[model samples]
Target: MPFKINTNLSALDAYNALARVNAQTNKAQLRLASQLRINSVADDTSGYRVGKELEGKVTLMKAAQGNIGAAKNTLSTAESALTNINDLLIQIKGKIAEANDPTKNLTALANDINALGDEISAIFTNTKFNDTALLSGSALPSSSNFVFQTGETEKTTINFGTMNTLDLASISSSGATSSNITSLSVSTLETAVQDSLGKIGNYVQRLDVKDDYLTSAITNATASVSRLFDADMAIEQLKATKGQIGQQVSTTMLAQLNFQPRSLLTLFQ
Candidate 1:
């Protein structure tokens, strides 16, 4: 290369190289400071897009988990109400059996049996959670199934079936007389309580399984999001150190190259 007084090509080349090194150093430092591999879309376009999609999915999944929790709570509240209703039915059955005995006073037995029936009706009407009725006839849905969202996908749902009215009127308890009580089918009331309890038990078990599954899924999704977005601190620090060294070396070379043209001028002196 020919040496020129007006322009030093070697110094220009060294300065450009130093600028590139400085830019790289700044990028590495930014990664270390932010603790994210993809701070901007320009850093890694495809990775950034994919990471954003994954982040959205994670957010939706978290919201779905909250929905699942609410569904579980609703089921639990219903289950507790049904359990109380079941106990009330058992007491009603005992009262009916006592009224069946010939030795008991008919009027006193009728009063006791009617009192127990009133309590059962009261429970059926009063059983509520979050101000929403759970056991009353008014609370029964037209469709048996209650769907709960369990995942990010629109199709992912947990369908709960078998919700039914637990009204005291469902059971034949108007027969307060001993002769009438002897004819009443206590077995029918027993069967209704047992069936409702069984359905509630099954629903609670399924909800528990779904809750565990969501917990695991959230953990895995969080890990995936982290892998896409989070920077490895150790690797970033090492890269920053290497870039810093390269910048120092390039700056020194640029300074040396600037002095080379002056040395050529000393030849004339």
Candidate 2:
């Protein structure tokens, strides 16, 4: 018999099998932890790119939604104040009618009417949301910038329209010889009130349009986010199955390699 050293092919086969099994195990774990088919850039670079884009849009949409909420509240306050002004104007009209009568005195009524005008003026000046008055004498900007995760504006045009300017000073202050009150025509007061009411209606309509836009933006953002990051359970199940099969096949191949080393036993026979 020839003197020879035998190599442990079984050990080499076992090592190879174990290495493959370890690799498959690691891949399965990564998929589970990340809950994504394309966890790394190597997996799907395009998916990562588009996923980040959608994520940015979602962030912008959230900020826009918050702005809409603030706009709604401010507009509501404007609407409420306008209603109070309407009531005040009606009261002033009644006072003027009483003053016109021969039985009533004008001096006391003039003071009361002046006070009502002052109160309306104050409401216009002082009414504020976060200390930014919507109906001030000067038109203040009710503007905000929505910053996205990508540090850019996804859609820049966010206008809540302008606030109504119902100038209280324009109303007549004279008691006995006023153009609006002394020459009292329901048509004139009605026209003024109707104009204010029309402005209020217009603002309310604008508010509704903004609200609807925000709602739609949020919906679309949510859908985009889901598409970008949500996992596909069906695809993951298939991958897991394939990983198990690969592990099994490698183990079988390793066993066959081990059998090759056992051929040395035939020499002894």
Candidate 3:
């Protein structure tokens, strides 16, 4: 090869190699310090976009999760109220049956039936959750988004018309006579209780599924973001070490090459 002092190609090559090594070393160290794979949009544009989109979904899913929880609480409240009312109805029916014994006091039995009916009326008036009447046949909420889900809110209508049988006060008003004892029936109230309980159960089951699904989705989504944005500590440490060695070697080589043209003076000597 012909030696040229004016243009040291070998030195230029060595300098370029050093620059590459320096760039690699800086990148590795930055990744290690930040613990992130994508430091900027330019690092991984597509991954950045997709990860950001998933973050938004995760936020929305969390909100939906809270909504579902509130909905379940509401249903639970209504269910508890109905259960209490059902027990009271059972007591009223028992009192009516005992009225036929002729051994029990008819006036006392009538008072007991009237008291139970008053309790049932109170339950109908006071069965509420968060100040919203649940069993009064009023719509739970005007807004459809009250309990937001993935695409929309889950809407359910529970009818409480059978609650009408809760009143045994009229027949047993004057006395627990034979006519009154025979006419009073709590079967309708029992059926209504079963129906409302079943409806609440169905709503709870659906909410449980959604709750489980959201939990899984959040975990999976967070993992996806980690995969795209989190740095691999072991790999980054290796890269940083390798790049550090390359940087030292390339810098030394560049210095040697830059001074190598001085050897050409020996030819003149």
Candidate 4:
């Protein structure tokens, strides 16, 4: 009620209301433009912190998904190489069985068998991708196995596990006289062939397990990324409605402020 030259009380009250409304309008404008309630750290510090943690989880999960991809490729290569080896064993077994019969030419059978051994060796030597041979013996001075490490926490190794390097060597005519081959009957050759198939089957099983693990990781990562960055349409829609009302209120408050300073005009009338 005090008459002051510089500050009219009614004008000051109107202006205070207008300023509050303006602040709300600005907030609404930002939310509408960004389509998000939490655009800046100032809007919601706790939300920003939680979002950062979720973002980190998304990054790690994505990397794990990639690790699974590389692992699958490696296992696939191994499976393919073993398949070739199995096929070779089958051919060798059939030839050896025919050679064992008196009706077949023993000398020609020996040549064919020797040729097969050489072919299997060739398969082993040639089975490589990205400069890494899957079938070849590891030349690591300390061991016959090779460990594939993706990171400090994850690793998968190929042990050539008990591949018959000896049986492979025996496919030659020079090694034909060995008891293992000379004594090999139709049943024995069949058993050897089956054993080769078994090794490949075992490797494939392990790959299946690895594949499953990676598939799960990819799914989880995909979900986490969605949670961290995706918007909620329902929540945003409600906010947009509220923002519209706030802007209107701000404009009305500004009009009221202008009129309050003009109250002196009523005295002149």
The candidate scoring highest on lDDT is 3
Note the Cα lDDT for every prediction shown: 0.70, 0.61, 0.77, 0.60
lDDT of 3 by residue, 79-164 (tens): 89889988997898898888878788876777778777777767777877778777653644542123345322444343434443
Residue-by-residue lDDT tens digits, candidate 2, 192-231: 5456557656755765675577577667867765666665
Residue 14, candidate 4: alpha-carbon lDDT: 62
Report the Cα lDDT for residue 116, model 3. Answer: 78
Per-residue lDDT tens digits of candidate 1, residues 61-148?
Answer: 7887787777778777766766776676677677667766778776666666666667766666676657766655565444544566
Superior candidate under TM-score, 1 versus 4: 1
lDDT of 4 by residue, 35-83 (tens): 6666777876876677667566646655655665665576567667667
For candidate 3, report its TM-score.
0.79
Clashing pairs in 3: none
TM-score of each: 0.86, 0.70, 0.79, 0.73
| Error at 240, model 2, angstroms | 2.3
Candidate 1 local Cα displacement, residue 225, angstroms: 1.4
Which sections of candidate 3 miss by over 4 Å? Answer: 1-7, 137-182, 264-269
Candidate 4 Cα lDDT to native: 0.60
How many steric clashes does model 4 contain? Answer: 0
